[model samples]
Target: MSAHQTSSPAAEAGDPPPVPEATRPVRARRLPPLRRGLLVPAALPIAVGLWIASLPRVNVDAMGDLGLLQVLPVTYFAALGLLAVGFLAVLREPRVRQPWAAGYVLALITVIHATPSALYPALRYAWAWKHVAVVDAMLRHDGAVPHSGTLDIYNQWPGFFQLNAAVLRVTGLHSVLGFASWYPLLANLLLVGPLLLLYRSVTTDRRLVWGGVWLYFSVSWVGQDYFSPQAFAHLLYVTVLALVLRRLADRRRAAAAGTPSARRPGAFVLVVVLIAAIVCSHQLTPLMLITTLLLLAIPRRNRRVVLPVLGVAVGLTFLWDSTVARPYVSTHLSDLIGALATPDRNATSGLAGLGSAAPGQVFASWVDRSLTATVFLLALVAVVRHRWVRRTGLPLMLLAPLVMLPSNNYGGEMIFRVYLFALPAAAFLVATLLVPPWPHRRWRAYASGLVAAVLLGGLLFGYYAKENMNRFTAEEAAATRFVTSVAPPGSRIVSVTSSLPGGELGYDTHERLVLAQDPLDQRRLLLTDPLAVLQSTMDDPRITGPTYVILTRAQEAESRLTGVFPVGTVGSVRAALDTSTLFQRLYDGPDAAVYRYIGPGARPSPPGSVQP
Candidate 1:
């Protein structure tokens, strides 16, 4: 050896001490089998981006997804397939790719959520149009008008409107309507942080957390994701839970460190502020918070933190409803109390009231029910089979929301809403069996990925299936606009169902009533079986008025799909209108027809206004 040369000491001494191949620096060799799995997540975003670019834009005439299925390009399905494949590929990868994989899944969710909005010229749903009107009213008046004929006491729950109005003011966005189509995408995206926080708090498994979050987005079908107060409230709900869970996790660490007294009052304060916001934002969410808190408190360890939060939730709900929204509460109180009288009846009515619905809607509804059942059932099996899921109290969280079901139909959907609330925990439980414990063999990892992909495919279908049945068209909106512009305020707006394009803001200037909404006729409405019900309601002095009787494509679809008329037919109603001299056409368009009902003793309508 040369005097200055630094040689391997073992070699110099003739001692052959070997270096392990597995322990070498990562860059010294090509990626391991597991690290190479990152290629899937790496390629996911690009494939998804290209697929989105290839899909057709939203068709403006359709209210939501109605008629959308026809125009959607093959690339739409390709995107869905790509997401499924990416999710599986990521799940199959070792820990090295999970962080990047999580990001990819979130990005995919954002794109999928915003698909309709990105594709459409106008907002997807008619209700979104009315939401803008509410914000406009709030902005112009700087306050809400109670029971404004079209908006109901939504003026009372004006926190969402207020928030949106503030955004409009700052961003100079012309209307909430334009952004409403993508509300589901954006609201869920915001929820990712809280959801991940909560899921991560309960479990150490990253795959389980990610899977549950994905499952939540997949199965959420309340349509509350549209630009509404409920969407904001849901975000608050998850965030509050996340904070609580984070606090619980902290306490666990502190106890282990012998510093259990460490405090974070700021977190509690933030939670209270959010609870107050929830109270003001929606009628039901505050109660839901209380229910969730109660569920958490049942486990003795959580009682201290949960009890105070529960009190705050109840107090805020009562305070807001009793004082600021007193009128709305009082008006709806009887209905609420009445609903509570027979819990079984209320729950059954709520569930049965969902109806098979129109054919497409029926398909969607069944898919929703099946998906929900499968999740709960899978959760049950996971809890029984896996100690990790059971000991963590995942099952308790899943059952907590069912308490809302016995209270009332909650506008004929309390049960479904409960399912929505239970979904997050349910998904976590479902993931227990699907994702294996870490440090497994490659074939096992691949198997887990394939299983997850199959489950994900089911989930994706449930998420987007509602698009076809819920959409409306721009022509319907134009006709509605003409009616509102020309017709006198407080004109009774008549429709067979509240499915018309203009009905969203009907409470603004018109006394609107859907014949199907008549308390006396719910049975017939549910069956869609009143052979001549429309004609009778129109002729009835008690129901009929000098009103604008408008029909839209959505109404026809609603009546047919829901079987809201005899044999689920809208023909009877349309035929009656065509033959009747009482209604003079006010506006006619491809998807909408507006009629001014000339009362029995009224003078003739202006000539040339009636359409054949």
Candidate 2:
């Protein structure tokens, strides 16, 4: 179409001859839509495979279904679609400003930060029920999974369980380990995306931004990195941070110009959604959100938006819990609150020595391998000196974590996920201090040392934390295997209360054995179901037949049982005991003993037979 003559720029005089038309201003060739879709499936397998491969395999069966092809396709496609949607949704915003070079570095830091718990199976016998019970309920078409009458609901955070079940429906993965581990990995990785966006919003220095990110995952003063629902809450907290900052900025600019700020409905909407997601994920998250929002409000002094935002947040939280969580919580409040207040049968005072002075214990623990304490101290110092404390609402943000210290000992406080809020704030405050227009050389060194200390502290703590749990893994594995081997196929074995001291903690794990149908036929494990046991006794007057009972010798419950023979003893399952070898598995630790039900004429008791 071009008989066009080119411009005669001083023609070929000052510059070389004009470049050929073919090479001039060439456009990138776009891939066809079909080609684009195909690339996702084709490229995905390789990436998913690589991601899966990178995961360390210790008792990988505990990881569940990584190799199971049945659900892999569903997970891959779902993750792909989600990522695509997120990308499209953010398209109108400015492109993410962080350098691509940091991807590997940030990922490495994430791995290091997550390293401690990363090695364990996603479905540990402890708390495994929280997830697997939901799976069981979905499979049963029961309204929800069934638990003893005394317990208000079958599990905690039933909503989160339902979400996990939805994944199972799409993927057709029934393995407790597979579903638990895989979703967490996916959720955790997705968590990084918002954090990156947050980093870009807060600062531009690549190193400082990443350091903040590093601290986000590294610091476990709160357990967000453990890949529980709290991890999801942490991401939401970041969004809240970004939103708060933007609102503050808008307010400040408006005030300076003597005009009203752009109080967009969209900003308010986003804050509402972020908060809903957090609450939907876990009940404890709202405390952090409310606290942070209040802190952020200090700078803006703008109630025009803040008031509405708070109202909306409160409304959504009420909606989430009221719909399902609150009803159950209300029903079970006495039980839960009671459990929290009373020291459990095997309970150690969670706060025994962890007073203000415990920082030394923390420091000593981290001296060899981790830098968490150093990182935190530096962040604390940086926060104070850099004026982040007084300048932004962050000073108040620090209080969220502080509030958790007292709660740890006040009954059920140690278990409350509310403690997680401190992690993001701590991390953010630290990064804010370190990255910057260093006012002085001494500040730079101090900031650098602070980061180093934190890094060192995290590494140390993570190492010991893992080591401390080594024997725990061995014992748990052995005990689980023994239970699986001895129990009859499809037999709903009621685990003695002693078998799971502090049932609240081990509930998740108990639920998983029921899911995996472990070799011992641990298809349905019942703990503290005295009514069920009493019913079984009534059904079989002969006290003869194939019925079996699992009991813990000399436990309070066993003593209460009046008359039940202890059939056999298996391995100890305590988390605190340390020594172990290949030949023998310890069945008891500093905590409790495990016993199997083996009396003759045993039968599962009918429901409603025994009263507490």
Candidate 3:
């Protein structure tokens, strides 16, 4: 039968005739709620982070008295106003925007609370807590050193310290405890959003993202260390990677053979800015990011690869040398390296330990080796499994943890700060595994619901967990608090000949500490040479007069300085010595007894002086 002449199916056999295919219309995909809600919580974190980064102005001299930081009321009010506007703008309906909005509120609380605490140790006196006491004492007497010493203990990360001080100034908060109190909250705030973003990027399943962030922050390192710039660096590292991934996805879409739209010039600018931010903040992050670009680019066309790669590499290399590397290479190599290595049974070691091959054999041996091994295997898997990661736009699955090898498991804890970029990447892989896929048509509520359960749990555990380095022990917190109490302004204290400041029960020396001198000689200096405490103090022309010194019980024998000259002691110190041996065993008395040296006026006249 001719097609048109054929009897209708319904007429011929009681079946209805089929409708023409051309008449059927396609239904458009409904957007996912999680993706839609993402931009909501991000505003506050972005502003806070920018605020933190902007505090260190090139011309600003913030190291003096921090009277400038006391204006938190003004900032808080302004921030609150912005937050209210943002809230009202986004919160036209709570059911639609509340989850993301809630995330922002928490983030603000975390950052505002956490940064001040972290800044206290860095801004109040010097760039580091371990060396604060020594630097404070020296700075109080004189600003310059006397002898030709090989190193500058006061110099760690001047830019970073300066930035910290500026935060104190802008916030108008000066007291050390006051600043320190901001740490926990800020640390949590900075950490939470990136983690949430990471989770969202990997899986539309909110539960997985939430769970992963919770797990990530639950580790103690994320909390107590929250007060540190490293955490911010970690946040930045992840954010840049996220931005890169987003750009790459956009690039892929634009480059697709059938796409009508050309590549956005704005996209390239964003990529460059992100690369610049990572490099300006820290070296290893840019290095890791560049490595990711290279690995990811190997299969891509040259036109796509050349510019961003060059921009990131060249920009990062320049910034690394100018900001972090060149300055540190000069004065801090030996001490920094020593801190990077593990000490022996007595806890004193040499710079020889710094460059040693196996610094990870110390405290982080297991984690160092484990992370390295995992990254190595994942890198291979990344190459083999590259298509999966590529489609997902997440090469940090391998790059983040891999680059950490240079610093991980090695010397001082400071290296951890450098390696923080690895964490967000690690979190990416973890959240990806935990969350499930979300297609355009279907909303996966179970997955979304789980987001809060696991992540919040992980965050809580990470924030408060006993073993995680993020949270401080009572002793550790107490020690840091003590440092805050006594820290001086415009001082560069080098923790030398003593472990008293960084912690209460000093544990000899931490694996990451480099003493004022050879760590191996640290005990010897304390036990035999009372004057070792005075080396930085005496040798540096900066110490023209008297500076307060803290000597532990281990150094009591040398305390008298030849057992002949009467050692001047403060009343607070005398009371402390009289009160408890705990102070004697772990620390010196009167906060090790504050002393006022009247110089030649108080001590015997210099040899040339006639008796008055």
TM-score of 1: 0.84
lDDT score of residue 537 within candidate 2: 37
Candidate 1 deviation (Cα RMSD) = 9.0
Q: Is candidate 1 or candidate 3 better by TM-score?
A: 1
Best by TM-score: 1
Alpha carbon lDDT of each predicted model = 0.66, 0.43, 0.39
Candidate order by lDDT, highest to lowest? 1, 2, 3
Candidate scoring better on lDDT of 2 and 3: 2
Q: Which residue runs of candidate 3 sit more than 4 Å off their true CA positions?
A: 1-180, 191-203, 219-225, 254-257, 261-278, 281-283, 301-310, 319-390, 395-397, 404-410, 413-419, 436-519, 528-542, 551-592, 596-612
Error of 3 at 416 (Å): 3.9
- Candidate 1 on 407-523: residue-level lDDT in tens? 878777687778767777787777666655444456766675666555555555555555543566667677777776666654667676766654645355556667766776554
Best by lDDT: 1
- What root-mean-square deviation over C-alphas does model 3 reach? 15.0
lDDT of 1: 0.66
* lDDT, residue 314, model 3: 72
Question: What are the runs in model 1 whose C-alpha is more than 4 Å off?
Answer: 1-35, 57-73, 146-151, 353-360, 391-393, 441-447, 519-546, 566-572, 600-612
